[model samples]
Target: MLDDATKAKWYRIVFDLKKQFGKKPDMNGLIFLIGVRELGQMREFAKHEKMDLMHIATCKLLSYEGYYKFEHIDEEGWPHYSLVQKPPFTDLMSQENRLRKLIVDYYEDNGLFEDMDQA
Candidate 1:
């Protein structure tokens, strides 16, 4: 289970994103949005392309923990990463929490929570 503070921050992020995008997004949606941002492109993605975007976002997030590292952006504009080490989180719950914490950290690092913190 998520602790109170973490849950609160997560909700704050959700609330902020809803206001910005005009709808609430689940965790996967947040990942997709992050992928869109990291890709540095603003266009509709195909179904498979959407999957690739989520992969890109996952790699970028895991890169924060030394599990992966950015290699280069491809000619097609997709960013690639290489595995530096094995991830420690194995089970589903642990993986979920890991991603959640990373998402929270990402939002906080990008200053997305500044106004939300005061509200």
Candidate 2:
């Protein structure tokens, strides 16, 4: 479990990233920001969230918008995302991103994502 300080740090990071980038962030971006170094781990997280499609589509949209560049790093064809300029929050989108990440994490920890996957 994450301690209070760690959670606060995550909140601040998400807040900053959102301030720099306008669009809502997806799972990959959040994972990347939290210092996840492996694309497979991120893919697992996506699989857990049932957000694989949403995450992939969001990455494509962000790439087209010139916010970042994405590369495929998985043998199963999952894309590894790298940011170009990072995100700019400065608005409600930042909070939204934070909320999204939190929700995803909650679902993951509660096995909701895992249960859905097995169903």
Using lDDT as the measure, which candidate wins?
A: 1
Q: Model 1, stretches more than 4 Å misplaced?
A: 1-4, 115-119
List the candidates' TM-scores in order. Answer: 0.83, 0.34
Question: How do the residues 1-119 of candidate 1 rate in per-residue lDDT, one tens digit apiece?
Answer: 67888878888888888988899988899999999988999998899999999999999999888899999999999999999998874888888888888888887777868857665
Candidate 1, position 61, lDDT: 91
Q: Which residue pairs in candidate 1 have backbone atoms (N, alpha carbon, C) closer than 3 angstroms, thus clashing?
A: none
Q: How does candidate 2 fare on TM-score? A: 0.34
Off by more than 4 A, model 2: 1-49, 93-119
The 0-to-1 C-alpha lDDT of every candidate, in the order given, reads 0.88, 0.53
Candidate 2: RMSD to truth: 13.3
For residues 1-119, could you state the per-residue lDDT of candidate 2 as single tens digits? Answer: 45575465455555555766875555566545433322234544554444554555455445544675876667855666777886566566564544455544544454644555464
